[model samples]
Target: MKRVALVGMPNTGKSTLFNRLTGGTARVANWPGLTVELASSRILLGANMVQVFDLPGIYDLTGGAEDEQVAQRFLSEAKLDAVLLILNACQLERQLALALQLKALGAPLLIALNMVDEAKRAGITVDVAALSEALNAPVQLISAKYGQGMAECKALLTGIFSNESHQIDFSNIPSASTLHQTEKQLFQRSVHQPPILNQSATDKLDRFVLHPWLGFPLFVLMMLALFQLTYTLGTPLQDYLEAGLTWFKDGLLVPATANLPQFWQGLIVSGLFDGVTTVLTFAPIIFLFFCLMAVIEDSGYFARAAFMMDGLMSRLGLDGRGFVMLMMGFGCNVPAIMGTRVIRDHKARLLTMLTIPFSLCSARLQIFLFLSGALFSPTQAPWVVLSLYLASILIAMLTALLFKSKFKSSEPFALELPPYRLPLLSHIWRRGWGEARDFLRLATTMIVLGVVLVWLLTNYPTQQHSYAELISNLLAPVLSPIGIESTLSIALIFGFVAKEVVLGALSVITGHEGQALATQLAHTLDPVSAYSFMLFSLIYIPCVSAIAAIKKESKSNLYTAFSMAWSLGLAWMVSFIFYQSARLFGF
Candidate 1:
């Protein structure tokens, strides 16, 4: 099969085009020997199947940014038939430099001017024939969003395979001046923009969203609403899922396993089913959260939020990019740590990676929401969750500040804020469904295993004094000071493997699931100890995946060891203080 790559600068509608062309049948594949993952899919174009890879968005081919380096390396390594260079038509003049760079590398390039509809709205015009002649390549005007000019674009891609291709040589990057001049000449000859462009909706919204004083506060409100909305909407669905799972267990699983020995039945029902299903109920909440987050990100407000927070971030020894990675950490710390590669400075990258684990990932969010809802009023539950988010940011900032002097970053930060547009339904569904699938996958696999282990430990050697009690009693002295009880200590021990298993392990050990488990937990602890447990979970060791990511990205066992030690020590101190302080205040 012929191979082609879709390459473009950030927010050039490149991924949109890739999805449109490949019908969203893409899978993420790690490029050989590279930490970055690219989306690749096989699509039938003109009776021939071709592998189309969507490369990470980059500003320049030879830039020092991690994404740029990945793009450069992939192009150099992959034997490709052609490169589909997608450029934003509205930003044609500025983007022409990349086109010229690719051209100079002797790459077989088929240029697609995407977002032409948006360009036309801005009163910008591009002469396709003139641009093609100037660049000596096939240039097609396309609006990948609405499927405009797709046929012509696909035809151009198909035609490219007819011509023989040469290896992309990146060693001969043109001088900046020459590339700039050629880009200018090409833009002048083929593109036209209105003398006075009207102010866009994005600009109008930014007046308030990006206001100096109101921006951060507004961001806080947005976050508050986001969490509140997630709970308000997702709680019902979670309840329904829990009910359905309970029905399945009582109605089907119990009957199916009735004939089995008592031990086997207990292992399958009480251990496996109870533990796994408890965690699985959070799948709806996780999906809903990611969907809302996708809306914020796709609307272009996330970039503006990063811009608004850059000053404070700089003081904390990070830039807006680090802030973005920290927000990404809310989804999962592993990828967020991997995302630190975008930071060019080694110290800053390491710092960002170290700080990301503090962000409250969805896995921990499950524990917080379950506990807060079980312990607090509905009106207060959202606030309790929001407070944890605040704690996450505060902790991350403090970590950065503590390590700033040791690992300083002077690399200048620059970011692009794309125009605010309504997010596509397809995109939203993909984000939500993908996250839900991942959540379920984790629950059924690792969480199930962890729960079974918890069940075994709790059920073995005699019902009067199980192995779990023995182990928890052994660690009781250390955990007791921090307000964590023996049973919770068992969950924390398995939590080191994966935070998703915490609730499952608790359910298995407590002999309850879902709301019943929450009720049981209410009997075992009060608000003070509950909050203390949440804090400890928030600040303590990350899951095995995140630890592996830190080790791989930082490439230092000592640094990885330090990260674990720092988080463990900090988690204990913070939790102990909060728990003790609350008790003193008569909470």
Candidate 2:
């Protein structure tokens, strides 16, 4: 198959165009270097099925960042048929420098002037015909976000592949200075633009969102609002889903299974149905979080948040990009670990990965929500959740600081600030569904397996001296000091498989669900112990999938083991302190 590589400077809509061309959602965030790895998809062009590779965004081929290196290696090592060079039309002069350099490599090239709509709206005009003539390559004005001019771009690719004209002479690539000069001259002659009469909306919004004094507070408020909205809006939907699942299990599943063996009935009702239902009930909160995150990300606020946080991050020998990845960790630590690829410095990437496990992922948050609502008053529930989030942030920062001296930071903080726009409903839905899909795909199996294991352990051998009881008895002494009961400790073991299973495991063990389960929990654990348990869940070793992601990204078993050990030690110490301190305070 013909392999075409999509190359561009960071945040030039290359990933968006790749999605449009290949019909794939490759995580189209508004920031640069998000495409840290090569993403390839097979697409039908005319009668030929071609493979399109989306390489990491690069500022220049000569740069030495990890992303830059990945792109460099792919270009030099791969047998590519053509190079599709994408450029942000609004930043044409600066973006064209890389385009010119790619052209001088002599590959059959096509230039995609992406975000042309935004460019024209900003009063910039490009003479596409003249620019194409000067570059000696095809140029297409495209708005990848709205799918404009894609058909023409596809046709151009088809022509290029059919003609076999993509062969490049790498012997005489131009120097960086020469490419810069050529790009300047080309743009001066072929592009026209007028000065803006007023500041852009992005500027106006950034004045407040990125203000020196207000930025941090606004960021805090935004995060709090996100959690508030997620819980306030999602709870009813969660209740509905839980009610429906209960109806299915009772009104249908239980009746149908009455004729079966007792063990089979228990397995179906108590094991599979209960476990799956518990997970599915939390889907609303996960979906809402993704939707809101997509909105903030699409509106270009995350980059501003990054800009505002760079100073604090720098103090820890990291940068704003790592902080963004930490924020992403709230949804899931696995992707956040993978997202460390955006950090150009090796040390910063490692540090970011190590700390992300402390980010209070959605699974852990779900448990916290359930516990807080079950144990505390309605007014105190949100604050309890917020405290855990704050602790996660503090722990991550502290962990980074402790490890900062081991590795020298390589790249200084730098990021492009995209213009602010109202997030499109379609885009938001796609992003939300994408995240939900990934969560289901990655976690469902582990959750179901863990549930089955818990059920088997608790139900087998008449439940008097089952495996769960044995394990709980063994761990009782170790857990007593931290105010964690044996049963909760057992559930935490299952939680290591996937945090979503913690509540379900507890329910299975206690033979209860909903408010009944909550009542049972309240009877077993006091207020201080409950809060301590939440803290432990917030900082413990990440779920199994996240460990695998860390191993894959870091390619170091030692480092991965270190991460697990570090988180485990920290969780234990924090929980111990909280529990002991609360008791000492006479609470």
Q: Pick the candidate with the highest TM-score.
A: 1
Local distance difference test scores for all models: 0.87, 0.84
lDDT of 1 by residue, 1-587 (tens): 88999998877877778889988733211111112458888989988889999887777876787767888899998989999999989888789998888888888899999988889889999898898988889999998878999999999989888555557887788744568878888899999999889998878999999999999889889999998999999999999999999999999999999999999999999999999998988989988998888788778777787788899999999988888888878888987898787778999999998899999998999999899999999999988998999999999999999999989889998877778877777777888898889888888789888998998899889767999889888989888988999778889989999999999999998899999999998999898899999999999999999999999989999999999999999999999899888888988
Regions more than 4 Å wrong, model 2: 163-172, 442-444
Each candidate structure's TM-score, on Cα atoms with residue i matched to residue i, is 0.96, 0.95
Decoy 2 TM-score against native: 0.95
Give me candidate 1's TM-score against the actual structure: 0.96
How many clashing residue pairs appear in each of the predictions shown? 0, 0
Once superposed on the true structure, which residue ranges of model 1 sit more than 4 Å away at CA? 25-36, 163-165
Best-matching candidate per lDDT: 1
Cα lDDT tens digits for candidate 2, 57-150: 8887777777788888888777777889999888987878777877778777888999988987888999999999988899999999999999
Superposition error at 571 for model 2 (Å): 0.6
